[model samples]
Target: MTKQAIEQTGLIPRSIIRTFDRFRIQLLSGTEKLVIQEFRISRYQVLVSVKCLLSLIILPILINCLLKNFLVLPLTTNFWNTHQQQIFLNSDQQNRAFIELSQFEEKIYFEFLLDSFNKNPAFNNSLSSSNEASISNQAKNKSPLKTLYSDKYALNKLIREDIQRKTSELAVFYNQESIIALTNLFGDVITFIIIGFLIIWMKPQIIILQSFLTESIYSLSDTTKSFLLILGTDLLVGFHSPRGWEIFLELILQHFGFPENEDFIFLFVATFPVLLDTVFKYWIFRYLNQISPSTVATYHSMIE
Candidate 1:
């Protein structure tokens, strides 16, 4: 049934998929498109090299959407309707049974009162001091509802205790399938996160290569350089150590007794890699140009 539905209408259009592929290739290849061409490397190769990391991001989203649409919504609705109907019927029956029991208890209490009333007034006055004190306090209040509530409270306490004793019997009525389904959902999320972390940790170099491309055609402004460097650094962290680097930085700050939640400090920690990478790369580029200017010019010309 699911296959038929999927075949009838695809998730996304072919044209859109193609456009996305082209955009990713163009973005990642950067000014290195010329270099890639000179080296006879196919753009498809570039895409496939990072496909696992890309899948780590994409597959979970697709799975969540599919599960919610096909499994969770439909199965949960059907299960609720079927399971809850029986529970409600049993609850109503239990309520009726309790009401009958309460009525019988009230009749016995009323009979005792009448029997006591029939006794001598002197004998009734000679009751225990504790019992007499409680009766007098209740009489002073003069609220029938309060007296009724006191009786009902005792009945409710008994009912609660009964339920606790019969917990195993009630356990059989629970929806185990729903519990299992939710557990599986949680496991699926955990697996997704683990896969994401593994992808970053195992293929750090490839992920960095996919982040940015060399551009020798034009002189980039400081702001553009900073932005690109930061973007590349973010990609490096995301595809290398995932949240490990961020957590490490936060831990270090905490260890030094620095305020971990300060916005400026967090921003500085986040961008530190970008600053360091940019400076190091700039120095390398300058040194290479000084030592072998012709080679650098030739390489830039090929890229252009």
Candidate 2:
């Protein structure tokens, strides 16, 4: 945070400008001679470095993809199908769902009649006859289907309540496997985030060490400087300070108020994308929201 950077940042809206020109001074005061030699890395070193990078990044993605295609997706699908079929095939359970659906239709029809009776004068006049006729028809036609859902006030109320209860029961039955799967998925995600945070925090010692060596190279000279540079270069991988991806991770952690300490992981992994995204995203959204409304409109318009 320098005056120059602040001034420059002020000139452009944060919505449009995603990054700032960061300046870090590697040399100390009272020293002026600083030189940086762009060292070329050999193909072998480049390949080895890339291999390490892939291990850090690609392995997780690969594992997740394989699990999704070969294990998780199939297991979930099979469990869901079998669980649903079992619940449906159960005589009591399936009958309940059927009874529930029938009651729901009856309720809708009754509501429609009620609403019509309210607004239609003719319909209102017919309501008394309709009720009495309905009772008489029920007395005359005593079929099993009619008996099951006869318009006896007590039976009707009881069935309606029972149907609602059964509907909820069926819903819970269907969602049982889903709940378990979600729990397991959530656990796996939390595990990975914890592992990632721990690995990054521990290895940052090496990363910071590498940064120091490479950044220090720009400020030294003479035999001691050359010796230091040679020593430093041998330790660093071509003066590259942990890739942009590394910085991205660090920023993500920081957005969650998780500084690179020597313990635990980020603030929490209780929720996965929700926290990772909210810790960074919604605040940025709030910032943009606080900015000029025109900018907000423009930002959304740009996306649209």
Runs with alpha carbons beyond 4 Å of true place in candidate 2: 1-36, 39-62, 76-173, 176-183, 186-304
Clash pairs (backbone) in predicted model 1? none
Per-candidate Cα lDDT values, in order, are 0.53, 0.49
Highest lDDT among the candidates is held by which one? Answer: 1
Question: Candidate 1 on 1-304: residue-level lDDT in tens?
Answer: 2453222234775447879987777676364866667565545545555675466567666776666567665766576667665432234334544565566556655654555445434334435446867777756754454444446665566556655555434443333433334435544565577666766775754554454233321245444544554455556543464356567766554333233455755676578756766775685386545543444555455435
Name the best candidate (by TM-score): 2
Tens digits of per-residue lDDT for model 2, 74-156: 77666666665443323433455678778775776676455544544443344455578765665565443343334456545
Model 2 reaches what TM-score against the true structure?
0.28
Worst window of 10 by summed lDDT in candidate 2: 30-39
Off by over 4 Å in 1: 1-42, 49-52, 58-142, 153-155, 158-221, 224-304
Task: Please list all clashing residue pairs in model 2, or write none if there are none.
Answer: none
